[model samples]
Target: MTTYAKIIVNGSPITKSNFKLHNINGRAILPSNSGKYHDRYALYEQEIALIARNQNPDIVLEESLIAILKVYYKSEKRHPDTINITKSIFDGIEKSGLIINDAQITRIIVEEYYDKQNPRFELELFGESEYEINYSINKKSIIDNPKLYFPIKKNILKRDSDKNIDKNINSNKNTVTNKNICAICNNEIKTKDYMTADGGKTLICKKCFNKLF
Candidate 1:
């Protein structure tokens, strides 16, 4: 299990929902933010990028990822929604070039706590290899439908009476000799490494397919 980076950015976490509507050409359009929130949000993203680069100077993850985010508020007044903060955090990570893209993140864990003296955001990132190990270890306890992770394992479909069933299926369905790009994640993948979905109208890598459906 590899931990890619752990970054600490000091400030109150800002939700992506901090946007205001503007009346342009007699129509209301929502821009990125209002007056004060815009400057604050931009500074927040910049802080995240700078800290992430300093933490993992030479590392940029390209694999599927998991992000653990913790936000410590300065007071007990009103805590923002944890889910709403993910967008800004992910966008900041992308700006930092810590990961190839935010789309690589497959799972996230969010937590909020009160700390009157210190307000900050902590982020921890893990790659796909780590996720796989944890998934296998906690499969029974964590997931209600484990098949979603391993939809096409050979041992699950193997039969004592017929040893050629797995071979036959592989030869017929997954024996493409060319490499193709996944439609969902836009990652290059070997055709034989995965399968098509949505009635053969879309080609998705196993990781993206599993993450999606």
Candidate 2:
């Protein structure tokens, strides 16, 4: 029921302390000035943006997520714990519009390693969904079955259309007023709720297509 994605950076991992907070007029404030972690934050921002842009179906969010961490250190040195570093990481993810809030994370798995050469943290954000798993299996089955292949599918559609000419005529009149039937689920599909594939031939509802394809 879990789906995850990995995050990689061109440079080292940014620790919590690397983000500075100065007291301006007796109040703690976060400044946008460049610092040692500037490069790292830039990379984080770019990576987050990349992930957000290429979301599977480009919409829908998994309410519950779990983040697994593998922090790689360049050398044997004292640093903040992975748990402590999580706040900044989660904040970056949210800032990039990945999740509604970091509070949606149900669990955390943290591990550290000595990388000596390449210093970076590997983050895997897992989403809990049983439907995504089943959808993958079903899609694979459809691809593997030659008898139920797309050509056969088109023939089946043709046969069904031949038998439903009167219904089709009536449905066409109401399509604009009622709902556009989804090609996949045969359910009433709203314009925004349906996605088209194969240059507009294959239509699927958002609920069935959300981040699965």
Candidate 3:
């Protein structure tokens, strides 16, 4: 299904070169004005920010997506890298709360051509179920070696076998020390992807978090 948050920004087409970081006493950030390109990116951010503001993002994806970006150009000049353009587009989408994170996207498709009149971009999202790795299956692939994706679903042990379980758990509590792992499944985060819950410090992966809230 072709479903996505309807977003549109009207302005000169932006490019990756238009984005550059500036340092203000050791804090790095997007520069306000460094060149025409930088100025254009600044404008792009503003336009996107306005487009994303105040809209309730209701769609969540447990799998990856097909992001088809059709970029229309005013001239035949070589454009910046498509990857950079994709970044510029979705970073704003994530910040605006359209979805949990952009890394949830598995495939990116870019189509470039001239549009002397009405130069702009068209972005559409599609489910990536046909291509993305299945979360539960990938995680628990080893059937012989059992591991827990979440808390035990049932108490399978008899009372006698459960005697030392609490002690063993408390003894190795700190063995796996990355606190930012997914609270639900305890998996190491895949990328600089993933989002925080609405009003909590807990982190959740897209597959797990999308099922909640």
- Per residue, candidate 3 scores C-alpha lDDT tens digits across 1-213 of 324545555544576443333222333244334332234555575566557554434555445676777887777755565556777777666666665688977777778767777777766666765543322325455557543445537866545422111222345554423335655566766664565432333444666544532
Model 2 alpha-carbon miss at residue 204, Å: 55
Maximum-TM-score candidate? 1
Tell me the number of clashing residue pairs for each predicted model: 0, 0, 0
- CA lDDT scores, all candidates in order: 0.65, 0.54, 0.55
For model 2 the TM-score comes to: 0.46
- TM-scores, all candidates, are 0.53, 0.46, 0.48
What's the lDDT for residue 115 in model 2?
A: 80
Q: List the residue pairs that clash in candidate 2.
A: none
lDDT of 3 at 187: 71
Question: Which 10 consecutive positions of candidate 2 have the poorest summed lDDT?
Answer: 130-139
Model 2 per-residue lDDT tens digits across residues 68-134: 7788877655555566667666666676565778887777777877787787777777786521222
User: Could you tell which candidate, 1 or 2, scores higher by TM-score?
Assistant: 1
Report lDDT (Cα) of residue 24, candidate 2: 19
